[model samples]
Target: MASRAAAVALCCLLVLAGCADSPVPTDGADSPSATATPGSSTAIDAPPAATPKPDAVEVEVIDIVDGDTIDVRFPNGSKDTVRLLGVDTPEVHAENDPTEFPGVPDTDAGRNCLREWGERASQYAEDELAGETVTLSFDENEPRRGYYGRLLAYVHVDGDSFNYGLITKGLARRYDSSNFQYRERYGTAEGIARGTGTGLWGACATESPRTATETPIPAADGGPPLWVSEIHADAAGDDRENLNGEYVTFANAGEETLDLSGWTVSDEADHTYTFPEGTEIPPNGTLTLHTGSGEDGDGHLYWGEGSPVWNNGGDTVIVRNGSGETVIEREYGG
Candidate 1:
């Protein structure tokens, strides 16, 4: 009896030991506490990473010149006129240059519309940016001077690009130069504004582009012997740096050979080049007047100006015959 009782006790002890070696099953979903690897997570509803802001310098905006230009004072107490990079705004007539807004039609209705939009754009710039402390970032590819010697920069207020904001509101268009930074972004913003018919895109009907042939040229008093054919304002390479590469071409449209001697090609700034004696243009032939220094060559005349005379933004080219009467008045750029 004792042996049989001992055997039963041994069997009970072995069964208890077997149970202790086995792992307990768990209802992982329902359980408040479950064994898991330390610091491991399921990552339910995690937030996305934040975008990095641009590297920039803090500057005080002294004046908002236009939608794309501002007078800014840097931290070092230096002030400069900074032209906003990657954007172009509608022209607002300055107090000094009342005719600065080029190509506005002579009609009262057209003039009124141009004035209204110009005011809106100017007001928006003043309201949002003038006298504000903002950040300025320059393009890595293009820094310092832009066209016309203005400091090129990207202005940011409260971490958002002010240049891009103008495009979003349709007050500006994407003007991509050779070293175009943020081209895709500015283009996308412009597309969105245009698609939604916002601001100028909706309000102005005359800003539509015209083909070269569609533009009309005024007839000269001598029955229009020649017409201004083409202009290369922004020349390619370091050649543009040299004043001579930029030129305006004139074509003799009449059948007769015309004497260009004593004729003048002048810009609004009064930079004029007088044709030398014995200079002539043959029928259906072209003559190029260069802005830089060069010896007089066939179909070419030099302006001999030390600095650029033509405004890259906008300018009027006035051509006159020997009598000093306006023969051809051509306007380009805005």
Candidate 2:
């Protein structure tokens, strides 16, 4: 009877041990059967990591407020209004603010002219900015962030620059006190436009007006024929030896064909070369002159001499007509 009781007790103990070893489902969602194996353990499954996103390029057009101020669009899809630096167009506001002598044409004609200038300037801006990626940098002195919390950046477009173009065309005047990056270049272009009276200056008649005078050249349906715009010294090596060669290039800015026969290129030293009889420069084409040349080097004029006559460091080159009148005179600074 005692032996029988011992066997029964041992069986009960084994059953209790098996129940303790079995895994219990922690939550109804997970299966109790799914568990780590003994000896060699299994790893818990985890989610994949996420990839980071790239930075955005900032750009804005704000609005074509007048000819200078524009609405800038921020990277966060926010809009901020900005005034352009280094240029001031004629005010279109209706303050009736009158100047001392040659005030802005308050008359209908003057007002109309101002409006036209504004339209042209806007068109130029669109031509420059549309479909381009840009970065906005603001002037330190000017409000870096406008009242609306928009970043005011000085626009640098495609590396060529547009501020200078506006000033050169007399569309905008220079703001001297402003720390404009292209101030000098813009100032120079403004001076040239004012001197030439290309745009608004041509309409104004006042002497010593608010703006400078522009000298008007008669409108030419076609511009000048083939004309040389640049010259460079074609010397090779450190010896600085005069390669006995110089080149004169001609550019035809007009639409008509320019015959090159009688045209001559001469230096102040009187070394002259007449164009070959049949040479012709098509509309908007370039013609080069060279000597002992195997085909013109890159189509630029090449004059290969046993010794070069034109000074390598610098010298004056003149293009002339058959009549000996000067067409263009360039001093080669190279």
- Highest-lDDT candidate: 1
The CA lDDT of each predicted structure is: 0.62, 0.49
- Cα lDDT tens digits for candidate 2, 124-155: 77776644554444332343333233333345
Clashing pairs in 1: 244-292
TM per candidate comes to 0.42, 0.40
- List where candidate 1 sits over 4 angstroms from the true fold: 1-55, 94-112, 206-334
lDDT of 1: 0.62
Candidate 1 local Cα displacement, residue 250, angstroms? 43
Deviation (Å) of 222 in candidate 2: 20
Q: What are the root-mean-square deviations of the candidates from the true structure over C-alphas?
A: 25.8, 25.0
